[model samples]
Target: MDELSALAARVWGELAQAVSTRGHPWRTATLATVSPEGLPDARTVVLREWDEREQTLVFFTDARSPKVQHLQHLQHQAQAVLVLWHPGLGWQLRMTVRTEVTFEGLAVTSRWARLKMSPAAQDYLSPLAPGESLQGLSPAGASRPHFAVVHARVLALDWLSLNPEGHRRARLCPPERAAWLQP
Candidate 1:
């Protein structure tokens, strides 16, 4: 591989490793999207899956969440940015991606099957929608069916590395190009 390809591959390697490495810095990423009102919204989200070959990342969220609503409002042309920072390595990756949201499908069923038995499932079981006001005691629900899966197809990734010796930056767009940028 050439120098640029090698560097891009290394970045993808870190992302793949973060999928199952709980302590990895990229395990939690900041997802930023534009709401229907043209306002920017950002939130921290867990890294559930990653595929280097497909240039894709996956995460789970509540179907009723504002993020979902934002993506849905954009429909087929939904675009978002995912930012990952590694304090230990002094590296940061900002990925531009096209997003797709699935409320029910194999993606949702399979993920739900694995998640339903875990404590994290409680996040989707709330009686009220996300950001709703809490008044009286919470009511118990049998099964909260608000699980949603988001698939992000990475279009380009801007990687920056900070080091005491020097700093480096690159922009990687798979299949065709990877170029170094001024840092």
Candidate 2:
């Protein structure tokens, strides 16, 4: 395998280890994407889950959010980068992954529901459209409700990370294409 690919595998393994030991990445990562006009937009969000087995990463956002729209349109040609900073290790894990949007599976949805969270998390999922600006006191304040239309489905993913170390940079290469480097 090429040096670049080998380094990537090493860095990816490090990140997978960190994710397993820590429930989430250090903080939310900045997810970057390009618009059809070639403009790039990025936002910081929590990494809800990561599936190293499937080479899959997961996050949640409002279905009507612009980022979700951009991801849906760019799924074919786009790549995503997840930067996980670790001060203890003095190393960061830069993961580059191919982007794919999907709804949470029964397992994932159940996990979300089961997490111990503030009341707002549940109310935020009310039937209201996700991305719209609220006019005033949203019904969100009046009632707590569980929704199926929650289109909680904006569950999209971006793929990719880079390792600056000589043997750590990785791309969104195929899963079986992984090779180990001497980092």
Candidate 3:
């Protein structure tokens, strides 16, 4: 394999690790998207799944959340950026991805099955929509209807390493293109 392929493989490997490794710095990424009003919005989100073959990343969110509404407003074809940093490796990865949202399909059902039994399920159980004012300890709803899954197809990846000796940067457009960039 050539140098660029090797580097892309290494970066993909770390992204896969971030999915299953709790507390991994890359396990939580900042998701940046454009709101319905055309303003940029960003928030930290847990990394749920990664598929190297498909070049896709996954995360769960409330169906009524602002992020979901934002994606819907854009017709789910808009591009979003995910930024992750690995403190231990001194590396940062900025990925440009196409977003898709699933609510009631098998994709949502299967993930909800696994999550509904865990404490994390409470995140989607709130009676009020995200950003709505709470009314003093309101009881959570009993179902998982609010759960939604976001599947992001990575279109491009920009990787940067902050090494003590020398910094390096690279960009990968996957399946075919990769190039080193000046840092």
| lDDT, candidates in the order shown | 0.90, 0.51, 0.89
Query: Could you give candidate 1's per-residue lDDT for residues 1-183 as a string of tens digits?
Result: 888888887888899999999889999999999999999999999999998878999999988999998888978789999999999889999999999999998999999999999999988888777888878746785365789999999998899999999999988886476788899
Off by over 4 Å in 2: 1-27, 104-108, 116-135, 141-183
Clashing residue pairs, backbone N/CA/C < 3 A, model 3? none
Query: What residue pairs clash in candidate 1, if any at all?
Result: none
Per-residue alpha-carbon lDDT of candidate 3 for residues 66-93, written as tens digits (9 for 90 to 100): 9987777878377899999999999999
In lDDT terms, how accurate is model 2? 0.51
Is 1 or 2 the stronger prediction by lDDT? 1
Error of 2 at 3 (Å): 12
TM-score to true structure, per model: 0.95, 0.58, 0.94
Q: Which candidate is the best by TM-score?
A: 1
In model 3, the runs with Cα more than 4 Å from the true position are 140-144
Query: lDDT at 27 for candidate 1?
Result: 96
Candidate 1 ranges with C-alpha deviation above 4 Å: none
- The true-versus-predicted C-alpha distance at residue 103 of model 3, in Å, is 0.4
- The better-scoring model by TM-score among 1 and 2 is 1
